[model samples]
Target chain A: MYRLFILAKCDLGYAEEVGEKVSELEDVSEVYSVTGEYDLLIKVNFDDLQSISDFVQDRLHRVPHLKETQTMMSFRVYGEDIGDFVN
Target chain B: MYRLFILAKCDLGYAEEVGEKVSELEDVSEVYSVTGEYDLLIKVNFDDLQSISDFVQDRLHRVPHLKETQTMMSFRVYGEDIGDFVN
Candidate 1:
């Protein structure tokens, strides 16, 4: 599987809403409303690069109030917590 | 000191230029032209939280082509290479 981080911008006051919608998508593993340059940070796991690219270009870009997006392909993830244990 | 991660978006094709200007800022430690929902990822160090916020709200937001930004204040950063040994 491929792990990708998507940094997306939402219209002011829509960060939480965008995060929730992206989280509910089939291949999105996790999403967070974070601070800094972008409003939302999304973690996605996909079968291949094409799947990720397709989702970003087709579905995500169509979301209302979403202004722009940046995608970071993770070659190696060495952070302490990859994802929060939400159980 | 505080280390901050800012995810910011630039108008298409301006990522590299914005990255350069941001890198030239007094306290900016590093800046990267990254892909995903946001166009840029910047690592900034400041003497205090006020400095960081002030830079973001006052200076960064004024950059002509900048669209938006989200900031993630690092409580603990555990990556292998904190900063590229740019030597």
Candidate 2:
């Protein structure tokens, strides 16, 4: 699986709304309203790199109030709790 | 509750080992080996900011092979699946 972490900056006071909207998108696994350079943290999983690009471009871009986003790809995962959610 | 996301860099060839070691620490929820500037992405939770500081300074610092870390605090969470694990 290909996992991507997106740090998003939303319009003022729209972080919670944007988080909820983004989390409803397909392949989105988690969404958190965060404090830092960005306003929200989004986790998305897909089967291929192309799907990741499409999701970011076609799906994520459609979310209103999102000002900017920075995406980072995850290469591996290590944790006992991981097995509980990942199949 | 206080949530923190830690971006960690590890010594050469030690990302996976460091991820496992860090994941065992108290409050750590997930650990992922990620690409780009950081080697690992870790999610941790605590009751207060002081606990977060203590975990980073005492617990996380004790883990071997960790070269550097950057921590970001999370303010809120929004998602349907959040109810599954957060109780």
Candidate 3:
């Protein structure tokens, strides 16, 4: 699978609601309200690069109050949770 | 806790080693070899912003062949994993 790390900038006071709305969209596995230039970070899982493009064009753009988005697509996932460190 | 989403650019062929070394460090939760302008994406957790600064200055900067770093600090985490969708 491919993972697209999206840094989203939403309209004022819409961060929380945007997170809730994005999380329910297809392949969006995680969402966080974050500091810095972006207001939200999203993890989107899909089969290929085109799917990611489709998601951005089809679903993500439709999320209300979402003003801007920057996606950092992953080439490979190196580590996961605490389980990785377990012996 | 505060979460810093770091985007790293590493020297050629050093991405895998960088990921391994970073995952062993303190407060780092996940590492991914990613596409786009950056080579790696890291999730770092700490008590405050100061700790995030320290990690960058004290530890992350020391990783071999790691050329650049960009941190996107998180204000709050909204959703996680499949369990969130389960009833």
Using lDDT as the measure, the top candidate is 2
- Write the residue-wise lDDT of candidate 2 on A15-77 in tens digits: 888999998999888888777789988888888888888998999988999999988998777
- Kindly report the docking quality category of candidate 3: medium
Q: Candidate 2 local accuracy as lDDT?
A: 0.84
lDDT of 1 by residue, A1-87 (tens): 556777789998887677666767777754555556777766666667778778888888877788888778754222122232310
List the global CA lDDT of all models.
Answer: 0.65, 0.84, 0.79
Listed in order, the DockQ scores are 0.09, 0.67, 0.53
Q: Please name the candidate that would achieve the greatest DockQ relative to the true structure.
A: 2
Q: Which candidate model has the greater DockQ, 1 or 3?
A: 3
From the highest TM-score down, the ranking of the candidates is: 2, 3, 1
Q: Rank order by lDDT, top first?
A: 2, 3, 1
Tell me, by TM-score, which candidate is best: 2
Q: What are the candidates' interface root-mean-square deviations?
A: 11.1, 2.6, 5.9
Question: Candidate 2 docking: what grade?
Answer: medium
Candidate 1 stretches greater than 4 Å from native: A79-87, B1-71, B74-87
Error of 2 at A1 (Å): 2.5
For B1-87, candidate 1 gives per-residue lDDT tens digits of: 556777789998887677777777766754555556777766666767778778888877777788888779754322122232210
